[model samples]
Target: MTKENMEEGVNQKNVESTQMKEEKKIDEEDTKEAEKVNLTKVTTFEELLEVVGTRGKWNVLTFLMCILVAFTSPLQTLSYQFLGATPDHWCQVTPLLEANWTHQQILDLAIPFSNSTGRPENCYMRDYDYTAAAALGYQTTMKDPSAVLRNSSSLIQCSVREFNLSQYISTVVTEWDLVCERRVLYSTTQAVMQGGKLFGFVLFAYLVDALGRRPVVLVCSAISIIAGFLAAASPNIEFYIVLKFIIAAVDAGQYLGIFVFVMETCASKYRAGAGTLIVIPWAVGYMVVPGIAYVIRPWKLLQVAYTVPALYTIIYFWLLPESPRWLIDQGRYQEAFKVISWVAKVNRKPLPADQVVLAAMENIYHQKAQGKEADSATKTFTSRLLNLLKQLLSLLLISELRVRTIIVFFCWFSASMVYYGIALNATNLSTDPYLYIFLGGLLEVPSYLLLWPALIYIGRKKSLVALYLFCGLCIFSVMGLMLTYPGEAEVAKVFFSQIGKMAVTAAFQLAWMYTAELFPTKFRSLAVGQASFCARIGSTSSPYINDLLGPYTVWAPSALFGSVSLVSAALAVLLPETRHCDLPESNDFFTKTKEAGAEGREQGVVDQDEGVLNPSFVSEAGETGSQIHPRKSDTH
Candidate 1:
């Protein structure tokens, strides 16, 4: 009886064991299949990022961090407008002031009225004996000593500078006496800052590539903060200029590093609006500066306030995530995996198989290695120059491409020149420079929002022309008001300036997109890079035009900007509209002047460029999704 029961129990146990083995076998097969699918899915880290979930919490956090880094960048660029501004200064007559003679009396006793404007001369003073004038109670022997000097026969340049610090407690202009003849130093400093920005972008690009973006940006930001503090305490203009150049350069790296990090980490889908998103945060940063400066009053304290914000970026060391792409490139696969897995988890998505991820990373490592080998093989500098020259030739030599390239380059230049011109003169537009600057920043946001709609309904070339036309007209109005009502119409001038600012800003966004659409894939990056170079030239020259022409006339900058904008508008009309047209692949495509047909316009194009410009449904997905997030605006 015991033997029969024991044999039955053993049979049941064997059946249970077989079922468990089958389940395990099935699980193993499913994992292997998943691994096989995932292993070949992506060869690069960027592709791997998309597979792991791209536009998620990780990406959002990264973008916000980048924005924080960008928030105070405008300070380095625009601060000089305020910090180097010449206040209501006059020739110093200290003895007259000590003798109970009022400012009006001293102004009259020593300063003469300008013949042209009937206003007191700020840079010129009469060779009057202040002791004798005060001894005489600065009376009519000086002929309206309370109003104007008696004679302009013996005029001299200001010997002792006295700044009226009612607006700013201190500035480079006031502290260093950079007024009148020395005023060009203000423009010189601004130009140097622009150069520093250019150099910083180039330097940081290399640094981030070598040391990784997270650390490089953070370290540079710290250095930038220190430099800013040192600048606040700068003993002289020479020292201040050196520190400012350093701040501008370091700030560029601060922005460039985080920007590159975000771009690498962001999905392709978000990269388009990356332009708009990227700029607004910087604008916000710029918008706040006026308020901060207004409250701080003193230039040194305002600098401290501006410099302290950069310290907020120090939290980046703890909160800022490193680019997974960078880590894998550095062969830090394990750390990259951990970051990727965290991203997937936060995004509520499953990750690719571990082995597959490791394999993809290894493949990317080899690809990077091959790239470095290629660079080394080419020997770096010489190859880059030759490639650059070849690109230049391709742009200039081709028939239709050459004219289009030139027109687009002008568009870039005019847009940048007008943009920086209006921006730099924000303070001069109104007595309340803070409000002028704040409103300028506020108004720019709508221009970006309206850009896509403008491109959609108004057509590209026409929209660009309209923006330039509007900007030019507004700037001209500003010039007229300044000339016609120099004493009044501050509000009107500020309002027109804001309108011009918005239009130029829209034109800037349009120019960026228009240039990309104008060129083919072959020359797109090179064209954009060259355009950026041209834009830098325009921006670099703007400060000089603003400050140098200031002594000649207050409206001189406006006149120049308005003229260039109008000319640019006219030039824009000559450019063939790119709206709904295929991106030409070669110079020959431009030579074929025939417009795209109705169906191509309605449904998108193909035969226009032939092979690459596909109108297929699959191609539509990539193009359409990205279109929703176009590069509407980008910060300089």
Candidate 2:
């Protein structure tokens, strides 16, 4: 062995060890710096609320906006009755029979009895010339038209109609003479409008996410105002129906845009309350509808009345502000800061003076600054669309989220089906449809009032389950009453039916807010829009279910609605309870935030990191759901 070689090797080993020590020291410093950054991140909505100040001037403005905007939706939607009411109609009796016989005698002598209704048929009449019969001194006594005709060939159908509108001043049915074969067209008019609503929910959802909430809302409001007025002046049924469809298309944006705006604007503590409260105006509008219809009594004038109120929405352009959270999410920090500053000024609150940003906010800002968002932003429309497709596919593709998504979708579907089913079919009840509708609207107030407390205490999942179960029970009771009493117990049937409607309305509102809370912010709008899209499907088909099944068996639609409600309630149990829980900001919410906290605590990660809590711990320790402790710089 050479002594010189051994010494050289030992020196080389020491040099290598020293180099490794220096690198390890540098890495530890970087880790500490990273931990410092984490300590400053804005992790939850509650922390954001701290910066914005909850329940201040900004909340009041957005709250008022929510109510005012929500009012326009139901008015535009349910105004069809006033615009298309079909008054009692009958065939025009020839002058020969008109002179000799009274109107009743003429109808009895000419029109056939309807097999389904046992009333005088509206279209067919005896073809024999009454003038010759009158000249021959034929009696003006009443007889069944079919009996007098003696053969099918002797009967004719009247093309024009005389409408007996003792109850109504005017209607589209009489103005256009849409009767007999055209009777079904009125329902089709309503159906087509619902179809338009179905499409609009999806369209506005995309626009809301792609564009911005404020602009889309204003654009839709303007369209609604214009379409509503044009519809009022529509010269014919076709024109009227087309305009109605346009109104329906724009109607969703007014409702959903404002709804999402309010949900996004309010602090976590007030989110549920805000969601339920916005529907009060809708209930008011629902109740107000029948009164307006009663007062106007003329279709065109009623249309005009419905159109006028929506004009106030234009003022929203000035009143409303872009959602700051959404802006920050989209990498538009300057705009977000501007909105926050405006809100601060209006709210009389001061912003954090230092250039310090929340750790979460900083991370997002850094990513955007590093061109993570820019590269995607620069991608073509096709690429963006494909990305959207990929995102949607992920909803069903991920096992954990897939179940929640599917169940929530069903909840939305059933909630919508029962809601619109009872709402639209209220016309067929024993009571005057106007009064019935008013009562239905009145019931919704208490329903929502009850929802606020129930959601806060009992929790969203349980409250929904209970509400849906109660709705199903109410419907089932109505069906039982109908079956037991058959054509008799009208009072009991109507009362229970209204109760069912109230429950369904509450369920619908819950589904809206709960579904929003279920998904992450990344695709919340798209998820809600998809849920609403399913809802529209249920709403669109409700009429057909009622009409088609109603004739075969009076209990069919009610049974169907009740059955679905019950199933949905059961499905709700499988969904993760989100009430009072932190809303996930990212797609890996349950894992990265919640599970990470648990894992970090187990692995002593929090202890090693000098007691800076993980995201979930931060959320739990803050004011309310998803709130996080603020950094020193944020105290200002």
> Which candidate leads in TM-score?
2
lDDT values for all models: 0.70, 0.73
Return the top candidate by lDDT.
2
lDDT of 2 by residue, 100-217 (tens): 6666766756666787766777787777656644444335333333333445676678887777778677877778876677766766677777788878887887788878888888
Kindly report which residue stretches of model 2 are placed more than 4 angstroms away from their true locations once superposed. 1-39, 93-102, 114-118, 126-159, 357-361, 364-385, 391-394, 593-636
Cα shift from native, residue 169, model 1 (Å): 3.1
lDDT of 1 by residue, 508-620 (tens): 86776667567653455456556655666788788888767755678889999999999999998877655444333333334333232333443333222221121211223
Backbone atom clashes (below 3 Å) for every candidate: 0, 8
